[model samples]
Target: MDELSVKCLLHANDQVILVPSACGLQEMVNKMNDFVKKKSVKVYVGKTKVMVFERGESTTECDLIIENEKVEQVKEFIYLCSRLQIIANMAEISKKRMNADNKVNGA
Candidate 1:
């Protein structure tokens, strides 16, 4: 989670657990709200976003809400001046590393 950008990351191994449905996500936010209230910290719900990085027919339009305020769903959003994308596969990560090394080696 990047506080300055007001972004959060929720990751899970798809094989081990199920990604929550829209209703389930709402329940999570409600729980989070309760926790925040206990700590006396206010959550800036306006900046909240929901990003899902699955390689399938997943819903990009997540109707997640906090305090009845709608949170946005994004694809390929830039954060901290860098495009943040999910490295879904091990091969992709290896390919990216190879490319970076080649560039540094002036190839």
Candidate 2:
């Protein structure tokens, strides 16, 4: 739909595509086809990754394709090194706490 909005974030050689809905994503992909051809930029299909973030029990999966290349789906891909480190530290703390609790309970 033309009314739908899509956002593209460019950082270095990477690009982040965001859409409000699945239809918006389709619209963005359609526009990107024209954009790729017009810009004459080589499509790096192998390097492309897609991450779909949704809430609750819905099991619907969104597939992102650009220039006829299907992008790989990732469970988690952190853009910020600091954020990733924080997640890692949190996991370590949780593990240590669980171990201490188990020892105390003699489990």
Candidate 3:
């Protein structure tokens, strides 16, 4: 996915709990919370206020702004997420890649 899509995924705050497939959702949540708590950063998932740390405070706005000025950083984050997804689904991806390679090579 592109940077915007990745950002959207990170910023979504719907009540519906999406069961993450291969990615560690709990770890992501914990890291996100820790980022806010440690950095004292404000974060918001749309209009819904997100409480980063249970014992800390809530983030009404995003301190880590995703603007055009930070395009490189955003791209890096997106690349990292993509790499994580690939690592998480390595077996499936390997199979697909092998199949495609075989087809291309007429094997």
Query: Best-fitting candidate, measured by TM-score?
Result: 2
Any idea what lDDT model 1 has? 0.61
Choose the strongest candidate by lDDT.
2
- Clash count, predicted structure 1: 0
lDDT digits (tens) for residues 1-107 of candidate 1: 12222224444311111243343656656766788789987667665556777675445677777777887776655644567665667887899999999999995
Residues 1-85, candidate 3, lDDT per residue (tens digit)?
A: 2111123344343332233231343344445556666887643433332222222232223232221122111111122234212
- The model with the greater lDDT, 2 or 3, is 2
TM values, all candidates = 0.52, 0.63, 0.23
Quote the positional error of residue 55 for candidate 1 in Å: 2.2
Ranked by TM-score from best down, the candidates are 2, 1, 3
- lDDT for each residue of candidate 2 in 13-107, tens digit (9 for 90 to 100): 67777777777775677677677778887768787767665654335577778776777776556664422212235566799789999999995
Model 2 regions lying over 4 Å from their true place = 80-107
Sort the predicted structures by lDDT, highest score first: 2, 1, 3
